[model samples]
Target: MYHTWMRFFTPGPAHHRLGLVCLGVGLQHGTLPTVGPRTLDHHVAVVVSTGRGWFRTPDGRRTAVTAPALLWLTPGVPHHYGPDPDTGWDEAFVDFTGPTADTYTELGYIEPHRPVVALSDAGAARATVGRIVRAARRGNPLLEVETSAAVHELLVTLRRARADTAPDGEQVLQALARDACKPLTVADHATRHGMTPAELRTAVRRGAGCSPKDYLLGIRLGHAKELLAATELPVAAVARRVGYDDPAYFSRLFTRRVGMAPVRFREQQAHTVPGGWSDQVPDPDDPPIIGRTPTG
Candidate 1:
């Protein structure tokens, strides 16, 4: 028998507001029943372990995800999923909370909730599934760190998968990330890409799901996170590094979308590292913003 497990959170104080949960799901050589399109008030995720399946989302989007692939479902959007008929499917899923939950949604990292994805080249998926399953088996503080590390790896995998699909998108994203610490405009980007401003805007939205300007801004914010977490730099320097000339404006934007100011988020992360902080960190980079918004 397949059992569904879930966890919910009741927000009270800032420190007590986050929630996390995971489930191991399976369906024998039979069709998995269709369920209502459910929306998460927080972040959610699904990883297929075996078999093949198709899922129809609330918006009528049909996704064909096979074993070893991942289905990232962010909060506030209607979602529905089930097994594909040619073969049955088994899956593992996890949901958690943090300041970046909304930011993930804004980037479309969790939208269209049920896209069938190829799980090829995802080193983190295997390790994460193992960690989550082990945690369910062991249930200890060690599990918490393992799960958190796995989640971070999964997020990075999703970002990479988005870029690997479109080299142009990847290039554009890198450019945006690298330039995030400076002032830029679509026209400037278009000129660099050898495209007209209008053409660039259309291309960006079509491929990345957001206008170039918004995507660039996201990159800047992502960089701001790096400076806050990995360095001792003040928010002002971080803002400038990510292309925001005005620190106050950057802080406001970060707080509004990311749910916390840069300083607060940094503090929160400082105390939450899975292990001791490492000096060897990536060069404060921003990932390409794919799925920046809903397609329909």
Candidate 2:
């Protein structure tokens, strides 16, 4: 959601040789209204705080930005983007331009071709946007110098995101497929193209060093382990949570993958507690029924 009011500069008496303009725009939780496309001579950067959306340039390249992506727009580039209908978007944006405006361009930093750059540190990017917006609104004497400095940091972050994409590409895909479902099979993945299951298995192994089934199993077991470590549920409950209904089968698979049975793993961890352990207390914080006492 873009802010409803757009600030503009006055032409006459307001005109000055050294002008520093800053505006802060924020949208709450609602669908973005239709906006007419336009171009500007100022630098524009949008930091999406929540939800998902697509940034489409006039040339038809569309980049998707969700919770982790920052959008960069340069002067004189025609652009249009808004929130997805299902989930409304939240974003902070700032546009500033002056004599030192070429600093961003000189670095070849603005890549509107890749309109949305996913932020490695989303929190840091959000904080930076807040600072940029405040600096612009301050109308300080050194606005150009301060704003340019902030822009420099933003450019470096953008470059780092570009470099990080390649290494994480396959991992991201595997994670996506695994999350799509526990029953996600190699045949289903292979059908992503016209390829067969063997081809998909070969490709996944070549790129990820593991078969598709093994990769999916790793995801499932990783999820099961987290449940075991974080919750007090029984082995059956943990197995069900990770998509297995039969505790025995889940235990067999877990032992095969983890080199230990689930109960053994839990017992090993319990023995590591300081004063020994007891399951007599239904809740860890409450007092035990009879002979049980708190662990040291």
Candidate 3:
């Protein structure tokens, strides 16, 4: 409902020395609209506060740049974005660039691959942007420094919001459990899920109360026990089926971990009371979904 702005700031020498400055900012209501696709020399982030719109790249990729989130327009990236004429989005944006900005990108605070981060705490994000607008509009004496601080806060808000909306550490742990049969190292599994080895280790410990390696080992050992009890497969075949390449190596490791050799465990299980052994076996990673009801 307020007027949109596209005014440039007359930055001071100190702002230039700090290597960080807010070039421009605005609230894009119906008063201002994006005409077409074009690239720019600086970075801009636009938060869609209401309504709906679409963002497109030169590579023919398009995103539904909807409300409660923001989209990035990186420097020199051929991009186009606009609101629906009938349901134009209300947006607030800040155009920024400098060494500090580059440093944030280097530190993974600003990831182009994850251009649109959900404002899970929408009020906080709005409040941060409001500070930037206030600083700019008032032409405060320390406008650049104050606005820069607000921008940093905005970046942190983006990160916290995304984290708030992301799946829990336990979800990642359970996902890895589901694929326990895969011959993947803890580091490999962690990388696939966009986490470092250290991060994965900590997450596994926190979520599953064990190390990543140990969690997978528990799953593998559980499956091994099931196979040994229910099937007639040889030790070597069972080892290979459960992702162990070397039968002797598997036997040694299994013996060390399970407190008995694979063959001996099978023999001991065979004497167990009928029908009890099957129930004692834990289910596989992917269970049958034939009888499950779909949830919302």
- Candidate with maximal lDDT: 3
lDDT of each: 0.63, 0.62, 0.76
lDDT for each residue of candidate 2 in 116-160, tens digit (9 for 90 to 100): 777665666556655555655534665555555665565555555
Q: Tens digit of lDDT per residue, candidate 1, span 91-148?
A: 6566666765555555555554335566554456555555555555433645454555
RMSD, every candidate, angstroms: 11.0, 15.7, 15.5
Candidates' TM-scores? 0.53, 0.44, 0.55
What is candidate 3's lDDT per residue for 1-296, written digit by digit as tens? 33576656756777866776788777767624664577788777777777777777677787776677778778877777788777777788888777787877754567676666566545677788888887876646877888777778887776666543346785897789888878888888998889999998877764554678988999998888888887778999989888899999999999999999999999988544544443433356655468875231
Query: What is candidate 2's CA lDDT for residue 250?
Result: 92
- Cα lDDT, model 2, residue 12: 29
- 203: Cα error in model 3, Å: 7.6
Please report the TM-score between candidate 1 and the true structure.
0.53
